[model samples]
Target: IDVGLQTKSNIGKQEAADRAVVNLETRYQIMNMVKDFVRNPANKNQMIPFDADSTSASASIKAYNELVAERIKLGSSAKDNNQALQALDTQIAAMHNNVVSGVENAMRAMRIQINQVNQMSANAGSAMSAIPTEEREARALYRQQGIQNTLYTFLLQKREENALVLAATTPKGKIVDHAYAQSHPIKPKPMMVLFLALVMGLLLPLLLLSVKKLLTTKFSTQDELAEIIQAPVIGEICHNRHKSQLVVKPGKTSSIVELFRLVRNNLQFLLTNDGDKVLLVTSSVSGEGKSFVSANLAASFALLDKKVALVGMDIRSPRLAEMLELQSLPGVTAYLAKPGMNLSDIVQSSAEVSGLDVFVAGAVPPNPSELLLSSRVNDFIDQLRAHYDMIVIDSAPIAMVSDTFSLAKFSDAVLFVTRANYTKRNLMNYLNTVMSRGQLKNVSVVVNDTNPNVSTGYGYGYGEE
Candidate 1:
């Protein structure tokens, strides 16, 4: 019934120790004892010494009352100055004779020796009273113990029952276990735990791979990507059919390229603000198709006869340059460090994706954080905005790196990508906070890697064919 059948009332060792540190309260140890007793297998069904035989209850009560009445009457008569005291004496003599005979008969019947009931009652009462005092002393000792001591006691006596219900010393129901309850917990299933651990080890990367599929999220249907982003997607970019229709092999045709072209056309509609056309194609975390979306998006914009600059702002672990096979020569870091360097040297063209230009991050820098926030980088983006009709910047993994925030400032709006299964529920809140607290304008969620299976299709087409 508790977290692992933990009574939750156990005086934890720390709490016990804390008592020792200041006020001495055996409260902690006492709690441990009770918990141990309750959980003990040997005493599991033990009726805690409070159980009474209910079958003979009515007869017992009747007999007890009658006996008490007879005793009081005899005693009062014996003490009385009245002549009836003599008759009481006679009655007592008769009763004593009957008891002696009755006691001898029952001794044989029960195989037990008879003790004087009055004397036994007097002796037992003293012993029982002494027990309470002894108990009180033990509690006092516990109170002297420190919190750590209390915790130690609790830990040592886990699942071992101690006397807890002294006040609740009434007959309660017989509570039992289902025979298979591990007194020595078969729990934390070692194999299951190992299996779960292996699963956990693989979960993140698998999710990362899954999210890397669809880059820019513009649902073909209404709210197709709802599972990823709570924010209303700013706009839907229909599957563009531009140079995407252009045959990759002189005459070969494809619809996949057309799909990206549609995404690019929709992005065009979003860039109405004109001056700061720096588009941040970023996913919630890494592997959410942000790089692919950014690269293809820039290509799509360039195809419209618009001068487009695809800047790899992802200072930390830039993958866009690798994907396009562009020279990872001096790009953002190099050009930004030396503002006087020719932007043309860095502005290398993508060999395959036509009309799209890419600026590689060059070598991995020790200080990517400082590079994005550098004044030179800001001026470079400003300068690029003037030259290119649309400035599509591919930045670092949003969650992993702090670089995106600095680069994001240069952009007018941002498109956030989230992997359908990879993105956790909490990440949506994290993304929302990034935009809300940062006050970054035009932030939209693009759910990526939408699987055709498993997704609940909660408007996000999470698992659509």
Candidate 2:
């Protein structure tokens, strides 16, 4: 309502200012005509070109026309030195000066009126700014009154209902049996209690296990995950028995390393492009060891003497540098944000693995998705492709944020990571939906942290032992 009132008021003010401007323009036209008459009296028309629409200038134009007509008649009938003609010339000069003064006065008045209207508009705007707070208070009061009214109505109805029930109710008493006292106590039979206890002990374990199985929402095995997702389970990584997150180090032959090697092989087969391959490694959610998988997988590829560039694309929560124990230097974000930054300026060599360069996620940015959405990100990937053979991008979880989806377009293939017994089973259903909709390109799954016993059947220790 306040806004409507302000708008209506401003419209009125604008119309008033427009009228003043029109009146001012009419005065200017009158002044110009009088000046032209003074310059060329003979050619000046006896009937002035009067504007019927200009009410403010009508009287002045009439007087000027009369002066021009008297001068024209006297100049035609009498000598140039005649007194009447001279008198007419003096009157016409006075009228011309008057018109000039009127035009200047009209201009000044119009300026004053416009400034007044602008001041009023400023006042109205100030009032409008204060309306929101007043409106909020009014609405709050209205809501409180409505709540009270509803509560009072409900209580009144409930009171009337109770009164009606009381008026129609009847008192009746009946006894099913009389209270009695027993001579012996019941509930303390020793042999019965012992037998029940033994029965409960026998059934408790089975009941607990059944409930656990029924409540299992996460996949506990690789096959359980593989059965749900439409994509192939490229390979599975066993649970790392060691404390260090990096397992595929130099001169290491652990089962985890061997499994990563297998995963690496499967990824190589999936990306069949002749030149550089861009692989996006992400998970349904965090804490699924995607960073660990990314670091180790890159190491595994580096072990094959392939030039691998591991980029930490997860600018939201960058853990790749910390996990690799590398100094947190400027990385992909710098390359995307700064035009002068080169790949060598941000790329740091991995001390733990040779032939592998780590691109830290750089400083955590506030707008990670927008940064990745930049066209420079594609150029950054192309730069990596030109330099390295394999570009492994460890991105954010697909289910949690949109940063990965923006990076997905630049990848040749996707390596979706899921941890066994840690990742929810429903995530595979979501992944299947993503694959069906073609949101990701050439998608594959890599199950991380599976039970060592379940994964050892593939003979990870074929010749090491």
lDDT of 2 by residue, 254-324 (tens): 77778888888888888886863899999999999999999999999999888999999999899988888
Report the lDDT tens digits of candidate 1 across residue range 1-465: 544323222324323333333322233233234334334667422322211112232233233333434544444435656556555445544543443343334334322212232234334344334335775466557554544565556545532331432223333444585555546766777889999889988997887766863453333332545554556553332322333322222122233344445555555566676475788877667766677677766776776667778888777777766777667887778887776797887888755555667787777778878777778876787778777788888887777877877777778778776555455656666777876786456776554445323332233322112
State in Å the error of residue 75, model 1: 67
Q: What's the alpha carbon RMSD for model 2?
A: 40.9
The TM-score obtained by model 1 is: 0.46
Candidate 2 positional error at 192, Å = 27
Clash totals for all models, in order? 38, 0
Worst 10 residues of 1 by lDDT: 45-54
State candidate 2's TM-score: 0.54
